[model samples]
Target: MIWKELKKQWRFMDGVVIASLVVLSFVPLVVFSMNHKENSAKEGNIAIISIDGEEVDRFVLNEETKHKEKTYYPGKDKYNIVEMEGTKIRVKEDNSPDQIAVRTSWISKPGQTSICLPHKLVIEIVSGKSSDEKEEDDDMIITY
Candidate 1:
């Protein structure tokens, strides 16, 4: 009697496993098909530096060759060095224990960013040019 019950339940378990496998296969395809847009500071070739939600400085990456800016936070001894090399930008030196920002790769893209969370500082590349000014249609889009 026990063997019969076990054999009957095995079929239902097998169906559940098969259904799960089918759903898993489709998950990756759906994820890959969707285009994820990043929120960017639209200021063109400029990098915005903000500290504690306030804009502290902005740098034009193209004109600026190579330099470093030290950020000092009041009441805190922590400091972060924002470095720019050619068109690339990164946190070159940080006193934070993890040094995650220092370890991050340099970014050159218009929308790329590097952050030092300990100092509450964010560095983001911007286009400087507003997208709203262009009213003409471009060939980059395709319609059915």
Candidate 2:
């Protein structure tokens, strides 16, 4: 019959088509799982800024409204303005060429960071806990 003839002609590609569809279905699940893990691990609201490998400033992101610092590095006079509204911190202004740091969006989590390579500056969000408290918490988690 015509059906049998058609099946015989397409048999070789049937498995390949089905396998590709199955793999494509799992891609969205994997992407959403990774995004969930990153969001769940968010832990802090303190912003720490470092320039040239030295700690330059620290601000409680929720307490401060705004802060601006001008930096002189060798031949450049660069600057950054940090603004915090409620619990979020973001780079409101930056003098870097590409302005990547200023465009990085707002952050309020422990591991979040914004960096400007041309100016050698890095801003990181850190947990509010003291080192001793953090060490004890880590030990407890391991024991559990």
Each model's lDDT: 0.72, 0.72
TM-score, one value per model: 0.56, 0.57
Tell me model 2's lDDT, rounded to 2 decimals: 0.72
TM-score of 1: 0.56
- Looking at candidate 2, what is the lDDT of residue 2? 100
**Residue 28, model 1, lDDT:** 81
Query: Over 4 Å off in model 2, which ranges?
Result: 1-44, 63-75, 140-144
Cα lDDT of model 1 overall? 0.72
Clashes of each: 6, 0
lDDT minimum window of 10 residues, candidate 1: 35-44
The numbered model that scores best in TM-score is: 2
TM-score of 2: 0.57
Regions of candidate 1 where Cα sits further than 4 Å from its true position: 1-44, 63-71, 130-144
10 residues in a row with least lDDT, candidate 2: 66-75
